[model samples]
Target chain A: MPNPRLFSLKSDSIPRATIQRLALYVQVLEDLQREGADVISSESLAKACDVNPSQIRKDLAYFGKFGVRGVGYYIQDLIASLKRCLGIDHTWKTVLVGVGNLGRALLNHKEFKLRGFEVIGAFDCDPFKIGEEVSGLEVMCTKRLMEKSHELGVEIGIITTPPERAQRAANHLVEAGIKGILNFAPARITVPEHVVLEYVDFFHHLYSVAFNITLSQQK
Target chain B: MPNPRLFSLKSDSIPRATIQRLALYVQVLEDLQREGADVISSESLAKACDVNPSQIRKDLAYFGKFGVRGVGYYIQDLIASLKRCLGIDHTWKTVLVGVGNLGRALLNHKEFKLRGFEVIGAFDCDPFKIGEEVSGLEVMCTKRLMEKSHELGVEIGIITTPPERAQRAANHLVEAGIKGILNFAPARITVPEHVVLEYVDFFHHLYSVAFNITLSQQK
Candidate 1:
């Protein structure tokens, strides 16, 4: 479910860029909260995050006017609002398939957990790891993936399998009732329209950096 | 050094998105060229990639009139221009830091080599992994990263280490004479003015899908 705070904010209008920035702003605020900085102003947040105060104001405007004209926004209120808007307020029970290196790394990673995506179960064909735990999360066999996820109410699936097996993994995720799939495999994948897919290519990233660096040098 | 072709193309004032898409079109065309397709047009190119033909023509306009307006875009000519624009005409030498699952998976990946990025070496701190070969590429100690990289004239560094070590890897890369960094580590990194840094965060992909799904639900 989407955050009501985000819905309440932009009953009028919101730019795509503004919506995307909410994720970044939430991240910065989360860092602040961890640092014990409870009370913050827009100017301060902007300075620390290398963003413009007005831009921050506009981004927050999407959800609603939580900011005071003079006193500034309450830290907890904005954090809670952003958290809801970004779908991090509650726990995100996700399923990860193709538990290879990238998949294992993601499962062991605390970043997603900190952001609210808890990968409750992982899938793999490798018998050696299928019954083991990687950083406290159990590795379930692909055979039991759909049932486990269905019982757990997982709507998001992280696909970290290899390029060759990515399509098969995606098909399984869709069949298992996952509506959102993060395909880290390099090869492009086709999922049903009901399923939203994003490709996170490990090697194409290197290609992009190489492309940009090469372009900038040419100039 | 950067390719002479990319230098000549971007100097003509192409929009960033167009330039990026142009590179992709060139890649697809290269495949078509290999299959002996000489007179391909923008419509076929867009169809192959699921983009719009008008957008393709508009993007190509920035790089001057390469389209015949009737016979379609010249495959050989357009490919040559795109290769130069993206700076992929020359092979790029790259290094990977952090031989963890993510790093080793990439090291074993043969696609990077096929895409024109040669993985000259890999660096990590694991005592057992050092002096070992993965996918035929030797894993070297992070301690010798700078020396070995300079010796090989490596131009790009991919940071796949955990977030805590990501900055350290970037620092080492910068000190080692690398010009660009592609970070798989989930954090922001600071580098000098000359260094071109790009982040390929899997979280961004997740959050992006999350937001889109949320918005569409609202609709």
Candidate 2:
């Protein structure tokens, strides 16, 4: 059982790992829902997520009391609760900077739209790329980012620029009043305390695989 | 100082969090080396990595002793050691399935090649996609996966197929003698005990951003 008052507290009070797990739970729950599952026991859910059953119970407990004795959690209700906790119940307007191959793939990525992130604009500095239509949006000049971001009330900025240009692109997005940034460039960029930033490191998993394979071979 | 004997132990004895931090340290150290820095104190490295100085020291200590008392660590030597620890000092052959937009972007991504992963083959089931050239590799029928994988000595498989096809792709890769899999589709997959699997969840970061943005707004 969890203290109901914990839900009213600021989000920082909750561990980020817990929040990330909650996001993952939402993903798993949605899958179950698609499979026509009406309910799922904590043990079953934890198995699906590759986590301990008690860990699942503890994470959900941080938000509020969930599930019923012996019966487990109702799939639809649990999904709604987790989504609300993750702030994905409503659509988030986003602007993408850079129109390179990775950028174009992101624009065409249906998962973003399905998950409530709407890429309202795409911007690039290349004159050759400007005015080009990609995934339905006309590629706009990077100079117009601020104006369009404001006009669209964009909340998040996605950076897929080259490493050399990443910092400049982040600067433009912050200047455009974006609240969050997801950087795909293999470069580190600084942002203000108010703005949140996450990196899409493409090599981390590969390194893990390499390390494990090496270890297995050694044994 | 770390016990030198720990370095000879199997990698599982090491915490995954430590391995992940080591991976991050490698990234930060590489950046520093590129910037012409020859030595860096743990404090500086920690600051750049957004981790505590003591945490950096603790994570590095698991492998072996690092850094000098005052002059800190030698950047070039440290990178070489960390890369060797990560098993990325040598090249790992890989193959990519589902030559979609995301797949095409990955083929053009220079980071994989730079980080020692050679994408030796591109594969798809579509007749129109088969025989098409992408990033210097001809798209082959998925049916030939095992033959080509054996010929190329591929160790890793990259899955960028749609959610519905992801499991089948994993099955194909496993049968093709892949030692590890990196799945990009938004689906849960199962692989053999000897084979490792990782997911590129594009939605996790977006969910984090949404949660944080919502929290910030409430504040």
Candidate 3:
């Protein structure tokens, strides 16, 4: 139940924690819908998502009212509103840089399409990769990244290049006017203030879990 | 500065967010040390890590005093303490399942070694991939996962299989006595409550940035 007032709130006013929680909610609601659950209470949804029930209510309140006091939330309606709120309702055209192993996995990853992200183009510096078709899209040379990205109206850039080349690839993507970037290169890359950059460091995730386990064993 | 009291605190008493921040601090401190910096203030560290200065001080206080009020924190001391706190001071033997493109990327990812994680073994069901040498280790059949993991004293299990096989791979890993798992299959797989599972979904990161950018544009 996203209300009009929630929709009108200033974007900057919303806490980043709330936005992150919304992402979790989107996944949880989608799963609930698939399971044929038409109505879900905040407590049930929180348990399914491994979050606190009160946290769910607080986050949803920021987005607008979505629950009827006693009956809980309508799963389908919540899914649609969360999608609209997260902007996944519209397909985002994304370009992948680097056709290396990680890049190939990304191209073959079907979940992206299911979540409204379409990898429309790919770029690489290797001559062997250029002109090769992967996931039905022909790989282009990095030289054409800026030009091709603009031509295809790509809004998001995914850099799977090596650490040494990540910064250059980021610069090219920024020049191409990408509004957001998901950089898989372990190296950090700088982007303009207007563009959002999120690094996907699989090692970070591994390290987090490993650290916890190590600490527990020490006890 | 990390205090002795912080070191004495039980793992459960420390917040997960604090641990995550410690990981980020490890990276930042390592980078600063390499650049030959001797001392860093909370304010400077916050700017570098994109975190609040007060938050940095609060997190560090949990571990113990490492910084001098006037001169800031000693760079080398901070690095060692963070690494010790994160359990990265000791290497963790890790085994990877699914030697596909993503798995290959993980094996070749040098950051793993730098961060104190050693991928001692790799597993895959594909006959073509099994026995192939990658990043100095030969790929083994998935059937050998449990036996080899036990023999090698592997502490972590990394799953990079397709969504359909992710759960089975996880079960195999759990059976092998892995204390932690980092799954890259883009599918949710359950593990025993004792085991920690972290999912690496590139779409989730992309969605996070996309949502923020969309919200900004709406304003």
Off by over 4 Å in 2: A1-11, B1-7, B10-13
Off by over 4 Å in 3: A1-6, B1-6
* Fnat for each predicted structure, in order: 0.45, 0.57, 0.61
Residue by residue across B49-91, what tens digits does model 3's lDDT show? 8889999988877766778888888989888887777677778
Candidate 2, residues B1-219, lDDT tens digits: the string is: 112221354335766557767888898898898889999988898899988999988877766788999888999999988887877877889999999988998999887877889999999999999999998999999999999998889999999998889999999999999998999888889999999887888678788888777777766
DockQ computed for model 3 against the true two-chain complex using alpha carbons: 0.51
How high is the TM-score of chain A in model 3?
0.92
> Per-residue lDDT of B131-199 in model 1, one digit per residue for the tens?
888878788888898899879999989998988899999999999999889988866688998888877
- Which consecutive 10 residues in model 3 chain A have the weakest lDDT in total? A1-10
TM-score of chain B of each: 0.88, 0.92, 0.92
DockQ for candidate 1, please give it. 0.47
lDDT of 1 at A77: 82
Order of quality (lDDT): 2, 3, 1
State the interface C-alpha RMSD of candidate 2.
Answer: 4.9
DockQ of each: 0.47, 0.49, 0.51
Q: For residues A1-219, could you state the per-residue lDDT of candidate 3 as single tens digits? A: 112232444334766557666877887788778877899987898888778989888787766778888888899999888888777887889999989988998898777888888899989999998999999999999889888877888888999999889999999899888889998886767788899888777767777887677656656
